[model samples]
Every structure is written in structure tokens, then in C-alpha cells.
Target: MEYDIVMEPPTPREFVHLRSAAGMRERSLDAARAGIGDECAAVTIRADGDLVGMGRIVGDGATVFQIVDIAVAPDHQGRGLGSRIMNELVSWLEANVPPSAFINLIASEPAFYEEFDFETCAPELVGMDLTLPTESESSHAQ
Candidate 1:
């Protein structure tokens, strides 16, 4: 099916639902609502006025920036939406962010990210963390 990908800033409600549908555990409705107000910017693709894909950039706006919440609804996958989102993101970064700024993302699909010049950290520089913090001895918390 043909889709008209519209790129625009997403509403808080749309951000929450799309993040959830994308299986992103790091973001929550409250967090997105709180963080996406001014500094962060997002681009969403709508087909016939219905949201189908989205991508977002969140950061302190100077030294650090991370791409987050790139998602396309299941029925809309494999149709170049992902690439469109990444292209928009990269363009934004190139236009606004400084050369010394740190741009990063935790990609769900490593292969896809590589297409946009994102590479896995070398073994000596790799870092990983759990989205949920552990504060107890026996049980994990989210």
C-alpha cells in the first residue's frame, strides 16, 4: 500500500502510544510528557491523518543528544519508513548540532542503524545498562 509520510512534531499522547507499540522499555508516558516539551523534537509520519511512523531526538541541546523512539506501526513496517525517520533525524543533527556534540542511540536493530553510520562500540568501549534500576537484594524492579 502507498503511504504519504508526513513529518511533524508528535503530541505527547501519540509519543506514548507509539513508544509502547515499539516495545521501548526506557520511555514512559509520564517521562515522554515531561521530556518532550521544548528541548526535544520529534518527527512523525501520518498516513491519511493516522500516525504510522515516528522518530525523536532528546537531549540537553548542546553537548549531548540521543535519538530515541523510532517506531513504525507493525502494518507499516518494511516500507522505508525507518529510513525516512533516520534521514530526518540525521538531517536535523547535521543542521543544528555542533561537531563536538555527542550523538548516540541504543538501536533495537543494529544492522539498520549501521546504514546511517551508527556502529557498535568496540569491545573495549562497550557499555550496557538495564532500563530498570535494581535496589533490592532478591527482586528486580521496573
Candidate 2:
């Protein structure tokens, strides 16, 4: 009942699949194409040639960076695979990101991220997002 999982860079398609299987929000194909391949840091956990977990860091290498899309397949959850993914990601950031760089991540479970020293930015500041609806989707909603 044991499988060997190896960590490596993820392909765009694998990134999309991992995100979905992990129950994360579905991202646009265009965004995945543009981001995953060139992420400042990326890690893919592959079990038997299938992607089972992933995480990435993106943004300008010098001044700002965000850790995004940390996911582990539902079938593989509860095994600390997500933590392993974070370890790979944080290790890379620690070794490479500039001391002045602002590292951030929007954690579904703030407690999970807090284990890695990510503090909750509450009261004083909050994370916000503006998702511009697509032409068809917006029209349909009205």
C-alpha cells in the first residue's frame, strides 16, 4: 500500500489536473499556460507517473513573491504530502529569494501555513481579488 513519490517540475497539463484533483478552484487554461512553466519555484509530487500534489511560487524574483496553488490529491491527503510540498517550496524560497522580498500565500487553512511562519494579516490588511468575468459568463449571469 506504499507508493514512491518523486518531486519535480510540473507540466502545464499536470498542473491543471493536480489542482482539480486536489479540490482547488479551476483556473483558466490561459493562466496555467502563462504561469506554471515559468514559476520562480515549482514542485510536483508524482506517484507512478501521475501528479498527486503540487505547489509553486510566482512573482518578480527580487522584490515580491507569492506561494500559490498548494494542493494534494484527496486520495492522498492525510499523509502530510501537502507539508512535503510546502517544504520543497519554502526551502527553494529560503535559498533563493532576496531578504527584502515579500513572501505571501493565501492559505485555505491559515493554521497550515502558519506552521511555516506565515502570519495572518488581519485587521490592518486583508487579501483581496478581482476576477473579471469573461464576456459570455458575465452576460449569462445578468
Q: How does each model score on TM-score?
A: 0.81, 0.89
Which residue pairs show backbone clashes in model 2?
none
User: Which candidate achieves the best lDDT against the true structure?
Assistant: 2
Indicate the residue-level lDDT of 47 in model 2. Answer: 75
Per-residue alpha-carbon lDDT of model 2 for 32-80, expressed as tens digits? 7887667787787777777888888889889999998888888989988
lDDT for 9 in candidate 2 is 60
Candidate 2 Cα misplacement greater than 4 A, ranges: 1-7
Q: Listing every candidate in turn, what is its Cα RMSD in Å to the true structure after a full C-alpha superposition?
A: 3.4, 2.0
Candidates' lDDT values, in order?
A: 0.79, 0.82
- What is the C-alpha lDDT profile of model 1 across 1-142, one tens digit per residue? 6666554667778877876777665466676777665645678898887788988888999999988788988878888999998998898899899899988888678999999998888675665666554347336433
Best by TM-score: 2
